[model samples]
Target: MTLKRIPYDKPVLFFGNIRDLFLQKVTLHEFMKSYYMRYNNSNHSICGLYVGRLPVYQVMDFNLTKDICNRDFDHFMDRVPLGMQSTDILADLLLLSPGPIWKPTRAMVSPAFSSGKLKAMDVVIQSCGEKMSQHLLKRENPDKEIEMKQLFGIFTLDVLTNCIFGIDSNPWKELNSELIAAFYDCENYSILTHLKMNAAYWFFPENLRRFLKVSVLADDSVYFAANIIRNAREYRLTNNQRRNDFLQLLIDNAAKEEVKKPENRLMDEKHILSQSILFILAGFKTTATLLKFVSYELAVNPEIQNTLRAEIKSVLEKHNNVLNYDTIQEMPYLEMVLLETLRKHPPIPRFDRCCIKDYKVRGIDLVIEKGTMVYFSIIGFHHDPRYFPNPEKFNPLRFQENRNPHGFFVFGSGPRNCIGQKFALIVAKYAMVYILKDFGFFSTNKTQVPVLGKNGNLDILIHPKM
Candidate 1:
């Protein structure tokens, strides 16, 4: 047997970019940015690299990147498989499932996040935000520095548990919450955990990894979440209970006839369970990270913060001092702040897709072969001075003029973009409005500045140097 390889003339990293990532020399995001700066040229739109023996193509040109993600989406419909489908329940997640499974599942889950559904879910989010603001207002030491990440984590968990599982979990009161413990455990961000994941990606063969049960999620966490979902589903069915939650939507929409049809697979119990878990996993950490970044920005940029607060107040006053879906959408400056925060500190800084069919470059002599991995650096485009001038400076005004730029991929682009984006925005916006209504974030001596972020399974872990 002979080895197969794509002919490449542009910059190539022979040993692949994984070496620096494994050595902690640079993060996944940083490596991509560095590669773009070093090898990106007007001649070629793509670069060549390897993850161990597997060949990978890094897209550098913005037009070509747009084509891959949007125009030529059918040729690259699915993401690079994680090779854990047989052993891990998480493999079935909408974020991980193959195109066959992803298409119908995405269609089924999409309605659950519709404008009407989000409007109904606004009450639940408002309740959670109210509780969080109340807790902050009651803080014994007003001058004491608050850990915004932890606070936002609690707020997001509370909202997700209530909306996704229909569990009224007051995370603020239950600091030692069992559900919280399971969530963090399932999405572990420790260096060792990431190392294990990289080992699986770079070294272990797919068959061997499955034989050894090299799972991405923790066993205990999976079991805990499974039990909770099963119990909630069973109780609702038995009692004929209906609630305004994602779980309820799934149950109601579950197919009753021709259930064995391939197209109806999303209605299966297993798929529904998988999607429920995914909603929590996707919504929890990312939304919290957005809140943390926004808070940090507001603390450091007091003038922008004040302008945002004024917008929030004006919107609320017009809407009878109510924080709901309609009122949230009315606050344009608040949206600008969130947009700038996402640009600077995107929770997921990079995205990948796998070529399903051989795709020839329109004007070049390159053909992306089937099963080849394609990578795009969102942070690179986000921070590019060409797209965002003075990218390092937090300027909400930049967004005020151009709300959606071609380079902006915070929620991603094209058909496979994030489905829960509107849901996440509503939750974050409500929390910001509720908190800023009474409290203002200000920097103190204890305040820490974010220098870099350590990549996690589902999001980036923002780390500050002491």
Candidate 2:
């Protein structure tokens, strides 16, 4: 057995070069390119890296990612959501739990997302999408420049609140509400806050993190988010009423009594709260981002947008002007456009796993030590030329053409990929279809044509959809 030292790329920081990427303030794709080029090894030479003194093994090769995330699932089974072990609800989240905690939790929670369950919720999602369209229409002033993300953000908030709380009211319609205030208070969207948060997540000492009990989310936000779940569950238990929504699923599956065993992790109230909050956090931002990018792409590519509108019209006619899960699924071009959007602008830029056992890198003689964190580069691969021809160019045809499906890592690859991917796609497509069916998104004077913003962020403008 030989332990060969992995190649290193000199980082320009006291801690390590990892934070340098954040400091440069580049898009996720650009940051990956900078390192991938600087390292400049077709082989896995630069796969192991130091981000601010943190040793992280980044898998750049597609096959290697498949090996680590899929073929060797048992060896690399944990995702570092917060920290591996914490008394906080972060530890109990379906996304964060690994191995002993993750396996059972996944099974218990899987039923909530079955095909039948999702179909039941689409009715509400459709209504929310309609509400979103109406909201846009009410504010349809061409002179007044509107940022699409804000509108999409409100839309996502409405949809998620309806699904999670089973309440038809628009949470965003009235910003003065205590819960809304709590959400905003918890989230500090300033660039500086983001940099600091990234640094803390990447470089701050674990002991200090635990000692200070530092959390990226604010306590008020957590309290408010948890309270929503509490009130809903209490009401459900008191009344014995069941609704066709995720909240109902959580209540039904959640343990009525306090949980005594590790296997029954989903039974506890804290667990319910964590899952509920995660649903809101996860569903809101990413889906909103997707809508923004998709709209921007459609606006820029008017021809494609027109084609899509026609297709949406045709599909609605086929369904007799009814919007549902089945109708959204029927539109292939819409699906293609969204898929391309994901490929070009992936919400989540990276995938990670914790090495549970000593595993040998296939095709290469390297042993990834246990307890090591491995990252699969979603951004790098998405922009890779080998997989996608003219990777920078926006082309939905790539999906229609016969290209390697493995190249696209938007939702990610293998068993641990996004559980809510189908549902997310369904909701995104529904909103997109409805928006395009009635309105046309073209470049406005305030429009930032590029998908990536000036500062490596998503900042686009819209003057009414038509």
Candidate 3:
């Protein structure tokens, strides 16, 4: 049962030979399509890979990705080397850790994301959505296109404040609040930070948590969060009242940690504080990127936008403009629109898993030696015409009709898939529902055409310019 190998072209594999690794601009979708066509047509089919200090492989096969991400996961379980372990705490979160540490942390964190908790947090998320609508209305001028990146960032910041910190940052305020200022600093990915990331994989792997020196907020941000978490925990304890927010759930669960691990440092003060910081930082930026991309897609495709708005109106009339768990769940068109956006622009483009032991992929008896990096190309698969027909077009019908059920893998798959997928979906949906009900998304001349991602150390995380 030997599987076919897709041959790699030497010329393209030598992709980054120039003086600039950060500025190498290649149209990724176009590049992948050509690679897929060549492999599909070739007699000796093989996957293409770019060999360098890092063996970056670009695979377009959905079957192979499932094998790497699920069936053959033992061989491919660790995220790619971001640099060193000592510097990147965001990466250090459950998404980036290995084996024993990851498994237990996952077990503990899983309960926090249950449907009950998501339901409880709905009001907090809905509050943010209400603010986002007002915020957008204030910015609207006929025919004026606002740079949505910053605006979406503010919207997501408000969402994260309520979700994670249980407070309102009002990031949409004319004068930036302290929370907004810290959030802005946290979002800026500088060259020095990039170098520290590379250092994480090369030097101090365990010590290079994302809370280190990625930005000034990485350190100072933690301090502010500690005080917040402390006050919240104390308030919850002092008053026998409970709220439906992320902070409360985490704190409540933190108290029961000793029951699970009597020998370990159960959810102590530092642990709770660190987890809070991780949630605020990781959740906001990634969700904001998704929301902005969705908005951009709507702006560019007015027809699809009109169709969706119609559905939103029809559904809201059915449920009286209140998007409850049942109502938001019923909007299939909205789901399809989001699916299309995710397929076209996945926030985290690539995922990696390090080989923990020798293993096989599909029927191929290859050496999955320890330390072998098995990378999953999320964008490559999402854009591949094999899974998605007419990949570039803003067609929501692909998801609306369940034409390609296994096509989308934006939030990832398997056990390690994003725990916050439900959280992200609800936030984006409510935000869209509120904004579209009031204002229509329009394109501006200042908007950058064919949005380009800045290529460098942080290439795995894609950010769009407004």
Candidate closest to the true structure, highest lDDT? 1
TM-score of structure candidate 2: 0.89
lDDT of each: 0.77, 0.71, 0.63
Instruction: For residues 1-466, write the lDDT of model 3, one tens digit per residue.
Output: 1112435555333232211332224444444434555564343212545433334444445676677677876666666544333333333455656676677666766766788877777777788778776655554453445566667778887878776667766766754677666665674556666544434433343344533444324655655655767787788779876766766766666667767765784456555665677777777777877778887778778788888889888998998777876788878899889878888877776655666666555544344446555545667667667677888787888875673467477777666777788778887888788878777776655555556652211111112211
- lDDT, model 2: 0.71
lDDT of 2 by residue, 70-137 (tens): 88899988875454244375546777776777676666667767888778888788888878777667
* lDDT, candidate 3, at 73: 66
1 versus 3: better TM-score goes to: 1
Rank candidates, lDDT, best first: 1, 2, 3
How many steric overlaps are in each model, in order?
A: 0, 4, 29
State in Å the error of residue 93, model 2: 1.8
Best first by TM-score, ranked: 1, 2, 3
Tell me which residue pairs clash in candidate 2: 16-52, 18-51, 18-52, 255-267
Clashing pairs for model 1 are none
> For residues 1-466, what per-residue lDDT tens digits would candidate 1 score against the true structure?
1113333333324334467777667877787677655554445667666676567787767788889988999999998887654344565788877889889778878988999988888788889988987787676766666777677888999999898889988978878788888877776657886776777776676676555445556777777888889899999999988898899878876744235465744576777787888888778879988988888888778899889988988988998987678778899999889989999888887788999999987777777888888888788778877678888899988887888876788887778889999888888898888878887777765565544563322222222211
lDDT, candidate 2, at 144: 60
Backbone clashes in model 2:
4
